[model samples]
Target: MVTVLIVDDHPSFRTSARRVLEDAGYQVIGEAHDGQSALAAARVLRPAVILLDVQLPDLDGFEVALQLTADEDAPAVVLTSSREGNEFGGLVAASRARGFLPKDEVSGPALAALLR
Candidate 1:
């Protein structure tokens, strides 16, 4: 099974995402509401994929992605955001994130596909 780490500030979003991914045959190993916790979870859990919110309290998704990517066994980071702008696009291009998705655009199958 693919282990997933969900990093989002909203409780509803995190619960919903966990249900969706779990239903789609993905194992949710950890969840974090802030970037700092996300990084800690990533280090401990070492999930296969990280569904991360770009606007985190402690650190931004790009910073977390950079730190994770520097690790020897970094997991793939999929940035999630509601923002739609050129600046976001540029950040994604420069970061270590594997992909970016709008918060509402994500579906269980799509997330599963990303893991695959």
Candidate 2:
């Protein structure tokens, strides 16, 4: 199973996402509520993928993705948001993330496809 770190500001969403991914057989290794915490968690866990929220407390998800991908052994980043895909416009493409997913659509299978 792939390991993942879920980063989001909402406590309830994190709980829901963890349950969803876990049910689909992915191991949720850790979770962070903001970009700085996400970076710290990523360094320690070295998960295969990071389910990151677009809007964060400390830094935007794109900025976080950029920093994470700068590392030689960075994991795949799958950006997420409560807003629609078109809402972010070109910003998502500009990031180093593998893909973007609206929060409601996020799932283990969807994330797995992004990794592929």
lDDT of 1 at 7: 95
Scored against the true structure, residue 42 in model 1 reaches a CA lDDT of 88
Tell me the tens digit of each residue's lDDT in model 1 across 1-116. 88899999999999988888898888899999998898889888999899988899888778888987887778988888877625575898788778777888777777756556
Cα shift from native, residue 2, model 2 (Å): 0.5
lDDT value for model 2: 0.91
| lDDT for 61 (candidate 2) | 80
Q: Candidate 2 lDDT, tens digit per residue, 1-116?
A: 88989999999999999999999999999999998999899999999989999899889788899998888788989899999978988999999889998999988788778889
lDDT of each: 0.84, 0.91
Q: For each candidate, C-alpha RMSD in Å?
A: 1.6, 0.9
Q: For each candidate, what TM-score against the reference? A: 0.90, 0.96
